[model samples]
Target: MAKKPTKDPNYKVIAENRRARFDYAIEDDVECGIVLQGSEVKSLRQGGSNIAESYATVDDGELWLVNGYIAPYEQAKTWGHEERRRRKLLVNRKELAKLWNATQRQGMTLVPLVMYFNHKGLVKLKIGIAKGKKTQDKRATEAKRDWQRQKARLLRDRG
Candidate 1:
């Protein structure tokens, strides 16, 4: 038996968008901080948020996360935040310029890949610059993934 690779202890993942890979060809990944309301942060701490259908867009030179769902905290009844509100993303000027240029000039998109808390306990979003995949491309990706799984199983059994 072999020990699995040690996971990083500094980051605690809150949610992931597994479907993003199936729908788009990811090009580059960028980590950016999120501007969250106190109630929203509390809700995320309790965990059941979804970023699967969410996307990031640059508006007026600012990046905003759209369509992401962070469930309302039951305890904060009066201060609960909107479940699907557009949250602002914090990126530096250079990265922002790069992302904006890629999306506008190259027809790329910003998709949130993972939301996690860093060692400092600050919430962050890992977004990817992606291009949409066609149906044929998706099918081929699925076929390749299936083959990899089968190959792994065969190797394990033989060993």
Candidate 2:
């Protein structure tokens, strides 16, 4: 018998923004619920969504996700969602205030890190408070990563 792959309660990632780490210095992370249309939810389940170019914004005392691309469901013709529609994010007032304050600071912005299904099977977006990294900072980050990889390889070979 083989073990079947099951959705883990911890997290089942749907889409991830790989470039986020390389482009920004992440400061804080907050998991937020997303308000999705009927067709959008189905499209996300089918697994072709993209959050790589998406970001979160505070608007009129609420949070909104901008530029995330959830492809229209193929089965739904006229009712399909727009590919790049802005979706509302569900966060409490306190959390929203924190994000709003942080975003008001210089060099700080909100970026969506990943979208995942939580333990309750609800879709969530993990947004980060980040600062744009300078060219030198990016180079330093790459160097540190390279060194870590080299160290791990050397340790494995010696064992």
Candidate 3:
């Protein structure tokens, strides 16, 4: 019997954009701090967030996360945050410059890959600087993955 993987109580993933890797070719990634309201943080702690359709952008020399969703905290009805709101991301000047250059000059995209709480229990967002893939490129990637899976199966059977 196989042993199940242990779960870490402190480290938890609130949301992940699994399609980001499939749709974009990630060139580089950076972890960023997000500005959130009290209610937003409480909602995220309950795992009521989605990063699948969200992205990051550098605007006016500041990094911002766009279209990210944090569900409303029912108890905080009076001070609940908007479900979808633009949130500022914290990054150093040097990293901000790099991301700006990648997007403006190189025409790369800032895709949100994952949103989670680190070991210290602070929220972090991982954004990837990626170039969008053409349809043919996506098909090729799929084929390559399939071949790798088949090869691994064949080796296991032969060994």
Candidate 4:
């Protein structure tokens, strides 16, 4: 009997921006749709996009995603889209207005967290409205994380 071939795991990652966690204290999060070109969507399905450096901005009452990186697919015959193009976020006018109001406070900014496809195969972006954290604040967060890890280790040893 012939053995069946092993198939590669299927994971269609749209994008992810890791920097949002380290630099900001997130206040609220919103999931919104992404505007995409045909080639851009094709590239996204192939995987490996970066949203870690990307940010969301409200300009002229529209929401824009900046610095998101979606790489070109290797097998595509035609031209792939630019690596780091600003993509418009597809949100309703009222939603954008609300987000705009929420982000207008001092030290508050809109940041993209992760871009992934839903079960229905629609692309979605997780955006957060956050306040920039101070250096001491980041240090304190790190200290707390370390303490938690140590406490977990101690509990595991005892139990």
TM-score of each: 0.92, 0.92, 0.92, 0.86
Q: Order of candidates by lDDT, top first? A: 3, 1, 2, 4
Model 3 regions more than 4 Å off:
1-8
Best by TM-score: 1
lDDT of 2 by residue, 16-87 (tens): 999999999999999999999888888888887999999999989989999999888999898888899889
lDDT of 4 by residue, 1-159 (tens): 999965434434566666678889988889899898777787788786888777899998889999988887676657667778889998888888878888775547899988988767888998998999999999998899899999999999999
Q: Give the runs in model 4 whose Cα sits over 4 Å from its true position.
A: 1-13, 105-107
lDDT of 3 by residue, 49-127 (tens): 9999998999999999999999999999888899999999999999999999999999999999999998888999999
Better of 3 and 4 by TM-score: 3
Per-residue accuracy of model 1 over 1-159 as CA lDDT, tens digit each: 999977767668999999999999999999999999999888888886999989999999999999999998999898778899999999999999999998999999999999998888899999999999999999999999999999999999999
Runs in model 1 with CA error above 4 Å? 1-10
Q: What is the lDDT of residue 22 in candidate 1?
A: 97
True-vs-predicted CA distance for residue 61, candidate 2, Å: 1.1
Clashing pairs in 2: none
Model 4 clash pairs are 16-51, 16-52, 17-51, 17-52, 18-52
Q: List the residue pairs that clash in candidate 1.
A: none
How many clashes show up per model?
0, 0, 0, 5
Ten-residue stretch with the least lDDT total in model 1: 5-14
